[model samples]
Target: MLHLRVVCPAERTEDVLRVLRAAPGATHLVLLRGAALDPVGDVVEAEIAREATDEVLSELCRLGVDHSGGITLETIDTALSDAADRAEEAAPGEGADAVVWEELIARTGEESRLSVTFQAFLTIACLLAAVGAVTNSAITVVGAMVVGPEFGPLAAVAVGLVGRRWDLVRRAAFALVAGFLLATGVTAAATVLAEGVGLFGPGVLDQGAQQVDFVFQVGPFSLIVAMLAGAAGMLAMTSAKSAALVGVFISVTTVPAAGFAAVAAVLGRWDLCGRSLAQLVVNMVGIVLAAWLVLVLRRSGSSVGGRGSRGGRATARREDNGRPLAKG
Candidate 1:
């Protein structure tokens, strides 16, 4: 369930109330006229079924509430009311199976941006991977996988493609490419410096990294694992089961491949470097492809799960042309 807080203009309060009262999945409508000082209007609050949220938000956008007033949606972690129960039952589908697109797009947008924090995490993850590769440590490779933030932009790319958000796709792609390049370059430089300081031997990776050799072993299993991890990651995100993210994080090998590639290039092992690059590309492509496929399936599913959301996005997109599906 989602708790909706709406600050509506004085004249539009009745329209807002009517929409809420008429919505099957909306309950506990409370209206306080002239209670909003900043917007200087009325405050309306209600609990909405997650399955029905898209339509409700779309209607609110149609009324210009999002532009002129304000609307906020919060997840209700522990609502014990029978009214909330009835709201869920009255809605189109189960809450957990529903996809709240606005929330997803907004979240991915922020995560996919090129920020200082993103650079730091990517660099650190790559460095950890490089060390793991030279030392042939699977544990360190796993740690690098867990520490990597590449999934965010990768997810953004999938979400953007699904939602027809070209700008987001471009931004995410740039961040993904540029971030890996910078981190891999830094890792390569570090590898050279380590050799100069006698920290690493000249032929450390010549033995093919016995334990962590899988990082550069590009093959069918690599793509399959990445695809499976991508699908699971998208499902976890859409269903709001964030705990599953840890499993997804430790399942892919993009970070480790980048680390290995950097170290291999520094050691003049072009063969290993090429294979590691292939592994990295395969994982990235498989993840984005699988994630996009999952989102498309969810969006095109049955009315019991996709009715309000599908229609709402279509409706809102039509009404508010080129505005990111109602622009909330």
Candidate 2:
């Protein structure tokens, strides 16, 4: 269940109440007239089931409540009322499986942005991975993977593709391309600087790098593992069980591959560099494709045996089919 606090103008208060009344998921509706000082309107509050959040939010959005006032949502930790149970039962589908599209868009939107902090984490992770590759240290490589923040933008890309949000796709793509380029470039520069000193012995990478060769070897299992991790990542992100993300972070070789590629390029090992980059590409492509598929399924599940507040017209899924496919 979720708690919604709505600030509505006096003229629109009745309309907002009407929406709440119509929604089977809503219960314990409370209206505090003239309680909002900032917006100077009546404050309406209610608890709704997670399964019906998308539909209820959709209706509220259509009423222009968000534009005029605001809508805030919070998870309900506990609701002992029988009304709450009935509301959850009345909502279609299981709350855990429901896709609140608006919430997803908002969450991923922030993550997809190319921020300085994002660049710092990617660069640091890549540099850590480069060090791990040189020393053939599995523990260090795993640490680097955990530190990488690339998954946020990658997941955003998948969500954007499924939601048909071009703005999101563009931003996420830019973040990935620019972030990788910057991280790899910085790591390569650092490697050169380290080599200038006595930091690395001659042929140190060639001798000890075999242990980490899996980072560069691209094959069927590479894509398969990436796809599995991607699916899990999406499920962990979209579902309430976010703790599942712990394993997903280290399941792919994207960061390690980038780090290996950067170091290999600096060492003039063109073959290894190319292979490492291929591994990176394979992992990224597999993750995006798999995540997109999961989102499509979850989105469909949200609508089947459910309801949509201002549904889109049904249309074939096409890249150019910009018309919002009616989401349930």
Candidate 3:
């Protein structure tokens, strides 16, 4: 459910009240008149059902109440009264099934912008991955994947493709490319320095056990795994399921592959470098394609009432017409 707090001018109080009273899912409407200290108006507090939230919010936005005064709505865990039940019952058919793209973008934006702390974490993760690859430690490789922060930009890119937002596409692509390059460069340099100090020996690169599999040796199995992981990753992010996201993180080899490639390059082992680089590309292509397909399916199934739904339909139409989904 959601709680809404609306403050409007006194002159518009009755009009607002009338709208709320007639609204499909509004309940526990309380009006406090003459409550403003700044010569504005009154405040209306109400509890609403989650299913009916979109309708009510749409109505409020349409009424210009948000601009004239202000409208603040927040999700509430507990029901305040029996009216809440009634509100749910009164909601429109099947409720709103829209994707809420703006909200999704905002959420993804928060994830894509790498902070100083995130950079530190990513750096540490890449370093660990490099060390793991050189030492043939699967445990360290998995740990690095858990700590890697590459998924955010990847998710952004997926969303951008589905939504056909060129700006988002550009930003996401830039972030992904720049992040990989920076992480790989740093890890490679570190590997070289480690080799110089005898912390890692030339034999490390020659060990078959330490080698990562990468080649046209790729098959449907690799594609299937990547596709499933990508879908699961997107689902976890959208559903706000953190634990599921952890599983999704470990299921893909993006970070580990990059680290391995960088380490191989530093060690001057062309065979390992080629294989590791191929592995990285395979994982990336599979994940992005899978994520895009997932989003496409989601947009197709979403309700067509909200702006998000409209955007989705538009993107679908574009795809149907052979227009590229992602911006270059």
lDDT of each: 0.84, 0.82, 0.68
Candidates by lDDT, descending order: 1, 2, 3
Runs off by more than 4 Å, candidate 2: 301-328
- 178, model 3: CA deviation in Å? 1.0
Per-prediction backbone clash count: 0, 1, 0
Q: After superposition on all CA atoms, what RMSD does each candidate show versus the true structure?
A: 4.0, 5.2, 6.9
Residues 271-291 of candidate 3: C-alpha lDDT, one tens digit per residue:
777876777777778887887
Q: Over the stretch 1-328, how does candidate 1's per-residue lDDT look in tens digits?
A: 8889899889999999999998999998899989999888999999999888877877786787766677778888888999999999999988888887766776677778888999999999999999998888999999999999999999989987877666678889999999999999999999999999999798888766788989988889999999999999999888888789889889999999998999999999999999999999999999999999999898754331122445435433432343332222
> Sorted by TM-score, highest first, which candidate order results?
1, 2, 3
Model 1 residue runs over 4 Å out of place are 301-328
Clashing pairs in 3: none
For candidate 2, write residues 1-328 as lDDT tens digits: 8889999899999999999999988999999999998888999999989888888877776787766777777777899999999999998888888777766655666778789999999999999999998889988889899999988899989987876666678989999999999999999999999888968864777785666888998999999999999999998777766777768879999999999999999998889899999999999999999999998888764542122322221211211233221222
lDDT of 2 at 132: 92
Q: Is candidate 2 or candidate 3 better by lDDT?
A: 2
Top TM-score prediction, candidate number: 1
User: What's the distance in Å from true for residue 99, model 3?
Assistant: 4.2
